[model samples]
Target: MERRPRARLELSDRAWQVLAQAGGNVAVLHRHLTAAGGQVPSLASLYRVVHRDLEAGRTLPDRAVVRRDREERHTRQAMADLALASPRQGDVAEAVLRLPRSSSTAASAVPVGESGAVAGVGLPAGAQLVRTPSVRAVAEPVGQAMAAEGAVCVFGDPGRGKTVAVRMALSVVPAVWKVTWVPVPVRPSVAGMRRAVFDALALPGRFPHTSALADAAVAGALGEARVLVIDEAQRLPVPCLEYLQSLCDHPGTRITLVLCGAGTERALARLPQLASRIAAWQEVPRLAAAQVAPVVTGFHPLWRTVPAEDLAWIDQSCAHGTFRTWAALTTHLQNALLTTADTSLDRALLARLCQRVAPPL
Candidate 1:
């Protein structure tokens, strides 16, 4: 008999599980296999195994790099807790957090009970929800534009959660749409602003000048994205804002253009043509006491560790109508919790935390 080919090896279910868990790290696989009473295969053999599994559709070739901002991290945990607590209707937004980005680049699904780091107790709910009448009034029209191809403008008070809402929308929208979120830096020079848009769109950096760059970037995004959300759009000088108006000139391209910023209404007023093109517009306002419960719920568990009464006071003081201040207070509270592990937050501790606030941005 022709020398029997060395018996071909077939990985057991246990081996496949180990490989999948390692996400194709060959070194890890080898170690696991050797420890499991199997000989460590040569690199070439390992490669074949992976290749074969991929060809057979047994494994995904690439793993995802998942990162979540603070509010989102909390929303994810809450949704998970909600899911286990009551399995009926899940929080649609939280489901998106858990989904793979490639599957839903803008939307993701968050796992419950992963950790308290992201969804701690102290996060404010108003930052996460669009509770303002102005925001609620415009959300549908904005959602329609997002569903089609175009953009909407969200202008509001500083720290009123303009950025937060835009992010939350991305967390809820369908995956087929591409959501490109760019926050316009404060007082950015015309040139720098254009560069930021280009980077967000992953376009080439070189540009003739600021004006040309703005014209090109908006047009480029309109050509590709389902929706382009520009946060802090109020900072864009008149010239750039006017150029942005041109992006929606053609109704056929199907692009949603969202312009968001503090006091954006004044900026939009200057661009008559762009303002005219705006099918919908609104000014998001600061959070109210009714909304404090949601904000408190969203705060990471670390925030919850602080006594409720102390948090109530901080909320009342920061409720002076600024999201930035609210954020600072939360950070201060987080630091206090980390260093002291003192769950019993009081008015005195609040005073110490308040000291950390930068003279009201």
Candidate 2:
């Protein structure tokens, strides 16, 4: 007996456009297509089509290429602005430091924690919040943005405490302001985003079925003085970002939007309309060398006992001034201390723990 012909998978023009808009992100494209209400192929099938039909044949640009182009454009714009404002002395050094560093290089040089928990990573029991320079630097802008009902974008490499800084800043806002932290859904879409906002605001009614009704409900709730903090905002696709812009632009809504994420600046770059309206863009850098000892010691009691030289070695060897790494290292050190009767914190012990957390060199 003859077997039936295997079905073919093809992406329509609209789907292709969605793929392009998604910057060749197969997962996001698949989500958008599925959400748009159609019989979309399985993710694996879509990946096969994207790689074999689109990428290999050059019908679509590679994601890396798209990312590089965006980065170059941003770098040029930054350089121009820096040139205009920068003083003559130390201009080269300042420019080098200010330019966006690639994640790989930053990771090689430096280092998910829960959103807004503590120090971007969840605070271990008995851990104290240390006001590092990055945290202090973010607080003012965050406060100003909340007070003015403006937008602020807090972005940096992951695990550097960007989320915690924003949370700390929001903590001080006067009791009158209703602060809502909207958790960004994985592979988010406009609809998912709307639901997140509705749930986050604790609106009285169920989420509306249609876009118009949902927007109406969201805008009505946002009419109150509210600070909407969206953490992990870098996960937002273009459509979702546009949806946020719509809420912020709504006349009835009195909302201060704070977007926090790793690579959030690059995400915002995809939508200049939203980026242009932001009042402040705060970047949380890694803990500086000088701050490592003081900040890490303050972050946990365990670190207080570690000698300064050893702490410095830990930073250089693994932690690289990254709070998340430090948090992980601290946990490991704590476990070692508790489990082993004669455990000592030293370079040899740190090397073994660092191996667990640090990526292979």
Candidate 3:
């Protein structure tokens, strides 16, 4: 048997800086540090640091050790504008103190339930109507983006409810708003995306079929109430994403942009111009172990018939408590109950379904 190499307990400042420069790529940093001297940490230690940061709050896999100066200047402009909104700080301070603080701290913040409880409120919902703290988390930024008519990106794993959360958030927008939702095309390309935009906003045929004119037409159609939501935005061509960024900068017709998909951060990174201008970057989280009962029961009437223990099993074993997973499993079970005479969601039924959805070793 071979022994695994252990990670160093402490790393030198030079090693840490190298790791940061490498964008938290431990292997690269390790090679560099080892070539320089023996001060570098092993991959295990790197994983430890990454996992700890992830558990704490940071969602990105490789978060470069960032400093304030690295932040884009325009991103802070919004904060300044918000601060300038208050003519008198004294009045705003007094009012802000009276408003809720404990809950609105961060998107990941959850309410404290009784001792040993999940520390969050449960909104009994069903199907597309499923409501929870996670939805509220995604909604806040969307609402702010709507107000600022800026840009936002919502990203998460598959079936994590990114689409549903965006829909629910947009539902609260005023009726006067002109919204266009364009789904990603099968074979993504800049030209295809331009066509999609033109069709969605109903741009006139007389307009020249050039990217510049398309941007002009889209911008002209935009107002404070106009918003374009691109779903599965990760599949978008890099050029198109950057082109949309140009649209964001169009003189007076700044429209709100909501880009929702998995791996959205990576896609945005490819277009630094667009990524820097993003007003909000929200990640929709999956359901937790404790939320199995509340979310499932409220999600659909079928869940009411399922046993609580079975619900927990499905959450942990099958669906993993994600919004789409739960909804899909529910559908399969509902179909089983109706078409077949199963009529029951026993552990055996759930196990079989789990195997169908996600095979276990």
Scored by lDDT, the top model is 2
Task: Give Cα-based local distance difference scores for all models.
Answer: 0.56, 0.74, 0.65
Q: Per lDDT, what order, best first? A: 2, 3, 1
C-alpha RMSD of candidate 3: 21.4
Q: What does candidate 3 score on TM?
A: 0.62
List model 1 lDDT by residue over 219-324, tens digit each. 7555644667777677788867754555567443446788877777788888777777676676676656544444443433444455556566666764465656
**Candidate 1 off by > 4 Å:** 1-139, 148-150, 183-196, 204-221, 250-252, 303-309, 341-344, 358-361
Tens digit of per-residue lDDT, candidate 2, span 1-361: 9999987777788777668757778999978978888677889998998787755565766666666555445544443343222222242222122112222211111111222324334666566665556765787676666656689999989889888777655544444567898999999988899999989889887777898988888898898778899999999999999999999999999888999999999999999999998999999988888778767766676776778898998898788878989988888888888999988777789889989998876
lDDT of 1: 0.56
* Candidate 3 residue lDDT tens string, 276-319: 98998999877887766766665566676777888887777677
TM-score of each: 0.56, 0.67, 0.62
Ranking by TM-score: 2, 3, 1
- The Cα error of candidate 3 at residue 153, in Å, is 1.1
lDDT of 2 at 255: 86
